[model samples]
Target: MRAIRITEDHAIDVIEARVPALKQGEILVRPRACGICGTDLHILHHGFPGTCYPVTPGHEFSGHVVAVGQGTKGVREGDFVAVDPNVVCGECRWCRAGRPNLCLHLSPIGVGRAGAAAEYVAVPARNAFAVNEKIGAGVAALIEPLACAIHAVETAGRLRDRRVLVLGGGTMGMLIALASRKMGAGEITLADPVATKRAIATRIGIDKAVDPSALGDELFDVVFEAAGAVPALKQALTCVDKTGTLVQVGVHDVDVTVPINPFNVYEQEITIVGSNSLADKFAAATELMPDLQKEAETLIGEPFNIWDFAAAVESMAAGHAIKTQLVFD
Candidate 1:
C-alpha cells in the first residue's frame, strides 16, 4: 500500500507501507478521494500537537469498502461511504453530555490515529456513512469539512433575514457561506484579500465578495472569522453589528490574541462564540451535500493524484489553490 506519511522530521513523503489491519467492528476502505486540509499543512510543517509521527495524514476522505471486519453491520464490501474521523471515548463527561467534539479523550483519525491518505485505511464501521451514487467522490470527500461548517452554522443560530459576513474565502469560509445561504441569511458577504477567492464567491451567488480593506463601516448581523489570522479576527470584530454575534470557526495559532473592548461588549450586548470540529453534524452535512455539490466545484483546484501530494501542498501554500484533493488510482 502507498500512503503519505508525516515523519518525525516534519517532512511529507509518499511511502510504501502494509495495509492497516482491521479490528473487530472495523472495515477496510480503499480511499478514492482525500482532501488536503489546513490541518494537514499544520501537521506537516509545524508538528500539530497530538499527532503521532509517521502517521498518514488525511481525514477528509471518502471511499469504497474493500473488506469488512467481524461484528460490523450496516456496511458491506463495495459500499461507498464517507468517514467521520473523530473517534470519541464515549465515556467522557462531554461525550455523556452529547458533546463528543469536546470529549476529553478525543482521538481523531488523521490527527491521532492513522488516516486515509493511502491506498487503504481501516476505520470503525460505525464511523463510515454509506452514500448514494448520486454523490460524487469529490463531493463525498467534503462531508467532513461540511460537518464542521454545519456546526459553525448551528452556532451562528437563526440566520433568517440576517446579514452575514464571512471573513475568509478559503474552502471552509466558502462552506460557511454556502451553509448560511441555505439557512436563509440575507445579503451574504465574503471578505478576503485573494482576488480569485472573491471572484469565486460572487460566481457562486454570494451577494458580495470584497477585499478586507473594502469592507466599509456597514455592520452585519453575524460575522464569521474563518481566515485563521490574527488580523482577520480583529477585522471580523469590527464588522459585527452592535447586538450581532461573532463566530470564530478558523483554527488559529495558540498564541494568537486580539484585543477586545470589554465595555463595548457589555454595552452592546454582543455575543461571541467559538466553534470547534463537528460533533454529530455529519449526517446533516451528508444530507445537504447533493445540493451543495454543484457550487462546490468552483472552490476546488485541479485534482492531483496521491503521488503528487507535494505538488498539492505547494499549490495550497502558494495561495493558488482553494482546496486541493488527491484522487486514488
Candidate 2:
C-alpha cells in the first residue's frame, strides 16, 4: 500500500509500506476522502507530538470499511463511515471525567498512530460513525473539521439572540458563524484582514465580513479568535462586551503574553475559554453532515492531490487558501 510520510528532515515523501495487522477491535478502511487541516500544517512546519521520523500524516478523513475486526459486528463489510481521529485514552482522569480531548496521552490516529492517507488504513471500530448514503463520500471527509467547529460553538454556549463576532474568516471562523446562526445569534460579524476570505464569508450570507479597522466601534456578546494571530487575540478581547464569553479557536502563530488587568476582570467579569479539538463532536457533525457539506463546499475553494500537498501547504501558510482538502480517492 502507498502512504505519504513526513520524515525527520521535514519532507513529505510518499512510499510503499505494509499495512499493519488489524487489531482485535479495529477495522481496515480504504480511505475514500481525507482533508488537509491546520493541525497537519503545524506538524508539517514545526513538528508536533508528531513521531520522530517517517510517519503517515492525515487525520480528518472518511471512508468505506473494507474489513471488520473480530469484536466488531454492527459495521458491515461495505459501510461508509466517518472516523473520529481523536483516539483518547479512556482510562485517563480526563477521559474518566468525560473530557477526553484533554487526555494527556492522546496519540491521535494521524500523529501517534497511523493515518488515513494510505490506500488502506486501520482504525478502531469505536471511532467510526455510520453515515447515510444521502451524504456524498467526499463530504463525509469534512465531518472531522466541522466537528471541531461544532465543539467550539457548543463550548461557547447559548448563542441565542446575542451579538456575535468572529475574528477570522477561515474555515473555522466560517463554521463558527454557521453554528452561531443555527443557534440563533441576533447579529453576526466576521473580521479578517484577507479580502479574499472576507469575500467568501459575504458570499455565504455573512453580511458583515470586513476589516476590523473598517468594522467600526462595536461590542460583542461573544467573540471568537479564529485567525490564530496574537493581534487577532488582542482584538477579540477588546471587542467582547462586559461579562461576555470569548472563545479562542485559532492555533496561535506565536506565543505572547495574555494581558490581564484586575480592573477589567472585576469590572467586566468576562469569561474567556479555549476551544480545542472537538470532544467527540463528530457525533453531532455526523447529524449535520448533509447540510454542512453543501455549506463547506461553498467555503472550500479548491482540492489538491497528494503530489500537490507541498504547494497546498504553501498556499495555506501564505494565507492564500481558505479551506483546502486532499483528494486521496
Score each candidate by Cα lDDT: 0.89, 0.81
Q: Point out where model 2 deviates above 4 Å.
A: 50-52, 253-255
Q: Which 10 consecutive positions of candidate 2 have the poorest summed lDDT? A: 46-55
* Tens-digit lDDT track of model 1 for 224-254: 9998999899888887887899999998866
Q: What is the C-alpha RMSD of each candidate to the true structure, in Å?
A: 1.1, 1.8
User: Candidate 1 clashing pairs?
Assistant: none
Local error of candidate 2 at 192, Å? Answer: 0.8
Candidate 1 Cα misplacement greater than 4 A, ranges: none
- How does candidate 2 score on lDDT? 0.81
TM-score of 2: 0.94
